[model samples]
Target: MGTAMTNPAVAALIARSHRLGADPRTTNYAGGNTSAKGAGTDPVTGEPVELLWVKGSGGDLGTLTENGLAVLRLDRLRALPGVYPGVEREDEMVAAFDYCLHGRGGAAPSIDTAMHGLVDVPHVDHLHPDAGIAIATAADGPALTEEIFGDRVLWVDWRRPGFQLGLDIAAVQRANPQAIGVILGGHGITAWGATSDECEANSQEIIGIAARYIADKGKEAPFGPRIIKNLDKTVRRTKAADLFPIIRGLASTDRPQVGHFTDDDVVLDFVGSERLKELAALGTSCPDHFLRTKVKPLVLDTAPDAPLDEVTTRLKELHEAYRADYRAYYDRHATPDSPAIRGADPAIVLVPGIGMFSFGANKQTARVAGEFYVNAINVMRGAEAISRYAPIDEAEKFRIEYWSLEEAKLQRMPKPKPLSTRVAFVTGGGSGIGRAIALRLAAEGACVVVADRDAATAETVAREIGGTDAAISVTADVTDAAAVEAAVNEAVLAFGGVDLIVNNAGLSISKPLLETTEQDWDLQHDVMAKGSFLVAKAAARILIAQGMGGDIVYISSKNSLFAGPDNVAYGAAKADQAHQVRLLAAELGAFGVRVNGINPDGVVRGSGIFAGGWGAQRAAVYGVPEERLGEFYAQRTLLKREVLPEHVANAVFVLTAGDLSHTTGLHIPVDAGVAAAFLR
Candidate 1:
């Protein structure tokens, strides 16, 4: 089900690849045909001329064709880039490009043909649209793009798409062999010469870059201690669920897709609108995201204890205001020929006590909204990381929001890539929980890098999965910074890159709070909290360097939330780990990385991390059982099953995959729903 594109799909893909390009969001008129021509004899047919695809006129790319394509010999076009620099005017380069297209008998070649030709890729297409211009016009656009793509992408200054642009791109490509695409400031992007599928993949990757930039720019500047207050759990869950459908609609394009849902009062209350707009005004993650999430968040001030009747009435009022703002926005910017706004819709909805709600037509769209909300929270968190986040100018926000080219770019997108080549690094990988996650990601075809403190343990598990297409194992002490860094480096070296990191190596210690010595705290922190952060930081830097984004998993415990006797150090450290993941999620998200935590309850197996004497103390304190520990733990859970390491690993796998791209900055409890029934 998760296989790469097949031959038929590949042929049809290349022949009809022109359908893959999106126009620059700023360009109001003109489309360009752009693609790569292979020069060396084709390995498949030994023919030289190979026109991958053309950005055809008169149709949405979603339904493109090979008939629309015009193949060209690569050798002829390759000579053009070298000659362009000697030419004096744009006309000369345009004429040269046209000559190549006419010689091949295709539609006039893309205006960017010279640039595309010089790159020597397998597929390519180019577009001119408005959304791109909106971003190009931003002050921070170039810096933001660089942050997202790292050194793998090239940025070209805004120039007409003939000789000048081609020359600029050629020089950059010559210098950076790993560069993938070129972003033209105040213009559209150019992703050339890959499979038609790869062309589309490049576009999505660009979108991700833009999304992260916008998210980073818009977050609030943080200040002071975070004062947390408890609230009614039932109301928060109900509201988050009620809002989930709309949130799905507003962000992700499909419903009942991508990810499953869970809501928590603690999470919601922490994010609710006591000062949400004051926060959102800080700006969006970046300007481009405004095309979907808008520039500002709608806020609700209702208290958690408010009556349902009052909250419902207030929500409707907020919804109406949002609709009114939409009409005003469209009216102010709509061109005479543009479509009219006839519906009452809210891009974002806020319900007091339930955090924020987003609306979408389907699950995919809702996921986008969820991503926006998550980023908004991150902005708030990051503001604390740096200075307070401040809102961008309204004109700048409008530039992105109202750009038809940008809106059109969102018209069609490539299907979500199956999580085929992703990799996950799980510490303590040989047996127990780490083994479970290693197996899960391996099953998904992700190279599973299993590292453990024990060399043989890691090797044994690595050997077991050696039969898989992507799986590896290594030995290291998670607490040892050098070892953790080496493990991450080895994974990156072995696998091209790492997309998922699960910090699951930890031990538990239980004793009376008074009996817990400073050494106990330091030891627990070293292996658990400090190790998780070290591993996460190492992987974070690598993912940041890749500029492709990644996922990080921290294996914490339920004790982080519910306190008893003994686990003072372990519980505190686990709690710190959870909080650290949240901070890391905010900081690294701009690079497309998502950080999350998994809190498992009573997952006793192999090495007994949870079998500390503190359990006896808790049992004595709560007057439960020492022998029925599993049942005693399960009694509080709705599912009434002793939590297992496998359960936590499975959750990590899902979150690390394509299924939960919209989720980050929160903790998912794999404790059979005990946390769900906590207040009850």
Candidate 2:
């Protein structure tokens, strides 16, 4: 270890923490904390004092910055245990930590601050490693640790994290002065050393020891093959797509946001195991997981070739039962003095014969929950391979779940955006109205599927919004049924399910009835009329299956209602689309799928139709220069302002964002107050 000064010591600690947190095997998404004690001059007194710079609550160590570390006066933190009473010590400890802030600009200290302060060494690292937790949760964890490392490690019994836990660590250290680390039963491992490098090295060494031990034990006693004789053939991704939204609807408090589901190889393997029910009944291996995954997962039965409607009905029943069981669990554990907490709904769901599903307020949280559950599955398998898996008792779980300190971390999080967790599919999303709508939706936190006939443009637009999680690009001709189906599958694969569909793909043709050839008529009608039908049909299947409400917005034109000269084919096709939206609204209303249309006029800039020489042709018909055509149209409107693509996009947002939740089967004119195009 280098002979670094006090400031360098904290820097070294931060760097090392980032390295470990970046690896999922070491720590999954803000689940771990690290601290380093160093000498610093007090801002108020200008006197030298010891300070503990610990990872703050709700901060992700993987991407930690200096501001993410909470600095507290070590002397005050260390003195708290001596003065604290036995009752409500956790709350008292948090209050003390708040009072001891060294300079005050950083986030609140982590709940484990006292434990970090109590360690005698200069540097300390705490992490819930998958391998370490696997060993820690095994019934024979202490015995196994002793056999593996002899006296180099000390074992601590299960205790909820807070003031008492800090005292226990100090006691263990006193007994095992020469120990390099402590193995926390039913929790995690902690290591400390004189230098940051040494501390991290020790942490990794302990994890490596646990990993090898688990591997060897698994080889010695391999689990039997996971055989489910009557298990349905794995559900197809397309069919499984519909199941999550229904789950979201049931799980939500008021309005349902989208739910993201995953069924990777690991998830499928775990769910397919014959012992799935038994293993899942066992609690989560680590306490931190309880924040996201809860004590147990909801398991649903499935069958081969099950119809979507049947699966939806079954899920609704299971969800109701799950909520009842959660309420009962809370009632059993709640004390008269205890504050009422939210129901203990399962964060992760296991659908036998299909795979696992995780729910969150948004896509990011859902994905995080999925990641933690996957890690839990691996840890449980490893622990059982060595010995019977054992996790913290139910009482301990309740304490951690309801811990005021832990709940505060979530409460501190920023409010979600209006469309957070909603997924939208926008056809012709590469440019003009489609692109604007896609970007706008993404800005409001919706995961957008940018579907366009132009592959390159679709990809560019998707990248512009944000990669993968925010938007995904799919190339498909909406008029082609197979292509439309494929595009829908792409959206489901990327974002679980679709909550909004924007039918915005179209072209303009300025030809009189006599001049309009069959080819021209078919091209306009196929894209405007047939294309809308195909996309709507494909999306309707999913929306109906989801059973949660959804929105379908059609991008028609004012010409559809008030036909312009020499625009017969374009007008007729758009009219057909508008009529189709009304018919669809009539049929799909019972399923909570709202269908509506927006009739926009004179949105010439950036329009693909205008770029195809239609602008010049229309200008010639009106006896004006092509550049002045937009001005001419603007003057025609009562408002005398240009109707832009962004205006149309905003209108789309209003309709899809539940602003028009009570209104459907109607047309909204977005034409800058044009009397001719106004709806009567």
Candidate 3:
């Protein structure tokens, strides 16, 4: 086939990487692999998937699949690299590869096994692309890289392909414990980690750092050295110093790269050069360099005697023009299906004899620009013999520049509707609290599967919301572990993922401790406690396997904290549920699952529980008019308002949404004054 496989998860991952500010071209073409075991062949048999994952032969990594990847055995492939005759003989090599896999009894792996095997960490990555090769293959690459990375990186010149490269990397990593990633000259970079997502993150971070270094540290063009000597008129040096940090910040906050070039002569001369106009006309920097520097730089070559208004006007004009050009470039290339690229960015500036300017959104982007400019200079100098290096097409550039899904990912702040598309399964979804939570989650756009012991009630609730088709209502007693598993499986099969789960299905009783029988305790615990565990366990597997983060919300009661007289069985069982939330949060956090409990006090407004307690008994407890109990609870301090199911629903929505993205492992009070009273 001419193209490679693409799947939603891979697309999402690529989107995430892009949002982190990685070049789509750099990260898009290559495939990625991840597994559960940190460092084993397989978690089950201890056999490795060699490469663990390989990009399909011709697939676009922008859209790849778990199945599209070729999982090979690394040890076997490393051994075979030397024995193999040529690419044409790969068929024969496949036989030997099968033999190695057969040793582990039908466990097949990737051909890049040896490459991945070399990484000491659990995750490994390898890619070959022109952007990476452009920098790696340069003669002064290592020295230039060393100037930027210093002792933080491991830089290796080109080596023989296959096993030798892997071996060299392993040797370097073993020799240098501080190296988190490797830059293979003329090939690509490799990042490792304790987990797959971490490994992917490490890869993005290293590339970003490298890109930034290039933008920040590379040389400008040759000219007069130092701004003071080039300026025709002198200004207060103290004022210049004062402007330094602010200028730096303004320059670097929005570009791919900005660096303070130390080669004073190069900076000043280039700023004053006659070719500045021509270069600016063509575009600021190259397309790849756009991330390093916005397409062009601001030029200031007028005499130091120029008016302050003149200087201001020049800077403004240059910035505005560059923004216009960027928009034009975007408009010319982007398609109807593609998203717009934000182009009001100024990446470079030239202050005539004063010096050159560069900027990135951060220090790293500045560094990336430095490296890019150095390469640009080299490319220009080399063009004296051949053609100036032409960049990839505008369409390709737009594809990288305007990728939408990637843009949606870079939120360092809290957001709402984080779990909007997430699927949640709630027990007891028919009436009372369970139905409230399910409807609330659905209002937040979660595809909710409501499971209840009563079939008719479940169906009725599912239908009332006009979600008959989309909202699944499964009739299964929470106490039946098998039924819970089946329902969870059905949800996964339908949704492809599960992100939020509300364990609100429960049975309550108010018998005194001595009066509670063995059957009553067993039945209550089985439904309220064990049932939650079963559903959580099944959903956790689906989430952890997918590597997509998930959240679990347990519906508990205030009685779980306050041991009231004559409610021993219900209190104890609910307490167990709360405890389970804590333990599950601890265990599942590593797998990216967040668990929390919602404890409600006297929230049984219209439920059967209210029917059992509403008469004189409720009146005695409140000591108020029977009809005024709502106002009594509402005015019992704090906000002084009766709690609505909607209020509890609102709490659930916030916890599951972007508002409380960082919270986990605790009980939140949906009960107004009761929880606060105990605390006080």
Highest TM-score, which number?
2
Question: What's the distance in Å from true for residue 554, model 2?
Answer: 1.0
Query: Candidate 1's error at 499, in angstroms?
Result: 1.0
> In model 1, how large is the Cα lDDT of residue 482?
89
* Alpha-carbon lDDT of model 1: 0.59
- Quick one: ranking by TM-score, best first? 2, 3, 1
Find the 10 residues in a row with the least total lDDT in model 3. Answer: 236-245
Q: Count clashing residue pairs in model 1.
A: 62
Residue 410 lDDT in candidate 1: 49
TM for every model, in the order presented, reads: 0.39, 0.94, 0.40
Q: Give lDDT per model, in order.
A: 0.59, 0.82, 0.57
Give candidate 3's error at residue 221 in angstroms.
66
lDDT of 2 by residue, 231-278 (tens): 343445655656665666665644454456777777777777777878
Winner by lDDT between candidate 2 and candidate 1: 2
The most accurate candidate by lDDT is 2
1-680, model 3: which lDDT tens digit per residue? 11111433334434443343234434432232332122223445756443333432333345444444444445554566568666434434434655444122212343344456556665565543233433454456576556645655678765433445556777877787776666676445666666557766766666666555544543443221334445532342222222222333334334212133323554445445656555444432233444445554555555645665565555555556666777787788777866656646555555554544454432333434544554444333222112232333445445545644224323322343444446678788888777888787776666678888888888887786554334778887777778876677556433334568888877666566787899979988998888888888877866665455678999887777876666677788898999999999999999778999888766546553454453234445556766676677677647676676666677788788866768889788877767443522
Candidate 2 accuracy as TM-score: 0.94
Which residue runs of candidate 2 sit more than 4 Å off their true CA positions?
1-6, 219-223, 229-235, 253-257, 304-313, 337-345
Collision count for each candidate, in order: 62, 0, 61
